[model samples]
Target: MKRNSYAIIGSGALGGLYGGMLAKAGFDVHFLLNSDYQHVSEQGLKVQSTWGDFHLPQVNAYDNAAAMPACDVTIVALKTVRNHLLPDLLPATTREGGVVLVLQNGLGVEVESAAIVGEDRVLGGCCFLCSNKVGPGHIHHMDFGRIVFGEYSRQEITPRAQTICDELNSANIDAQVSADLGAVRWRKLMWNIPFNGLSVALNASTKEIVDTPSSFALADAIIREVHQGAAACGVDVPESAIAKTMGNTVKMVPYDSSMRIDYLNGRPMELQAILGNPLAAAKASGHEMPRVEMLYQSLQFMDKAAGK
Candidate 1:
């Protein structure tokens, strides 16, 4: 199959890893860098992964969307914190019928994304991976890099969706299509809700959050709350999903979550996309996730405190 043209909108860690892998596989991957535009243009993306380390010494990079050609598939790998920029970015590069896959954490993203790119063009991606950009043009990947592919406005997999997944697989991404996008988002959130919030609020790592008794129980409670919230929103995430996330956390590397890293660096964490949006949806459905709510407030306080 002919590979689709890929334009990575955000040049952060997630964007770098995914886009770098695709580009490394000989796909026509264009990286749209916010800060690392010049550096990546000159030095290319450097990916160091446990699977193997590779480098792209020359790359198709642009600083602004206005300079990019319309791509067959546009991966909006921006942190949900920067989603407000999507409308501006898409207009210049999202060709009609091109699929826009959002590779970000949290809920309510699909809805907003569909509004921007049209339902037909909006696809969703959930990345089960641990990776980060350690410096300009350099990414450090730890483990787990499978991608769950789904459509935002429909349950059935379109041929376009399958092709995109196939393309990702061609690029060495463990990509697969699912009939349910909402369940995938909520299932991923079972881990994100606890680790992301507590990783910051408690100043702990993933290992500390699950290894310690008090924090572990709180993690369980938060997971259940997220499960309940998912149900109230009409998605039945199975018990196994919760158990699986807990199990993975127990054995995975002792890593700092993106939120914790952001907090420590004094950059704004994605408090809204990961926690606040879900909480709002649950509250609207009359489901009160008390423990998750507390974590939300604490993160919010820290976010506010970090401000001048």
Candidate 2:
């Protein structure tokens, strides 16, 4: 079987871990990094994972996409806030007929990439990973590392999507294909909407939020509201999804969500992509998610205030 070359556009925590795994498996993987470019280029990438510790002495690291080789699979692991750069990066890093896999969180993420690469060549991935960049060239993988791939604007699992999943599994990253992109996205939001926002709103970790009855209840309420919002948008998310998210979160490592870490470091949270877009979708269907709307408003205020 032929292996697919990969380009990791954002070599942050999630990107670094997955890209590093691919590189460790001897696949052709190129990383386009920003702040960690110098460190990773000089010292290689380091991963401290629960599975085990590994180090790549050298990697294909570049500071810009133009300098990187075009690959069969171009993975966009960028924070949705920096998605504006996709117009420049996607065209530069993706080869003709290559697919663009979007690994960012929240709804409607694949739309921008699809517009650039064409719908048939766009894939959205819902990542269920708990990892963070602790330092330059270093990623801490605390727990959970599974990704569900879904074809954009389609409900069938394409062969290309399955092939990518096979490659990811070969690299020891648990991956599978989903027929319904919208459903998978909403299922991810079941956890993201509550935990990401509440982590920042209450200055709490996953374990803390789960341990506190009040915060946990609020999180549960928000999850149900998200379910309704998904239904309003014509997506059927199972009730078991709510229980599954909460159950898994309870067993999760006590860790800071990506949004919380961004807040602590004075960086912008993914307020628009994660919350604002979902709210808009719900409202478009003439259904309102009051709890979600409230959370979104609070996050908006917090994000703006933190900018000052």
Best by TM-score: 2
lDDT of 2 by residue, 1-308 (tens): 87999999999989999999999999999999999889999999999998789999899999988988889999999999899999999998999999999999999988889999999999998899999999999999999989998898789988899899998999999898999989989999999999999999999998999999999999999999999999999999988888888999999989899999999999999988899999999999999999888998998999889873
* TM-score of every model versus the real structure: 0.97, 0.98
Query: Which pairs in model 1 have colliding backbones?
Result: none
RMSD of 2: 0.9
lDDT digits (tens) for residues 1-308 of candidate 1:
56689989897778888888888888898889978989999998899987689989999999999999999888888888878788888867777778789888988776667888787788887888888778988999998888897998898888988888888887888899988998889988898999989999999999998999999988998999999999999999987787888899999998888888888888899988899999999999999999988999998998999991
- The residue ranges of model 1 lying beyond 4 angstroms of the native Cα positions read none
lDDT of 2 at 209: 98
TM-score of 1: 0.97
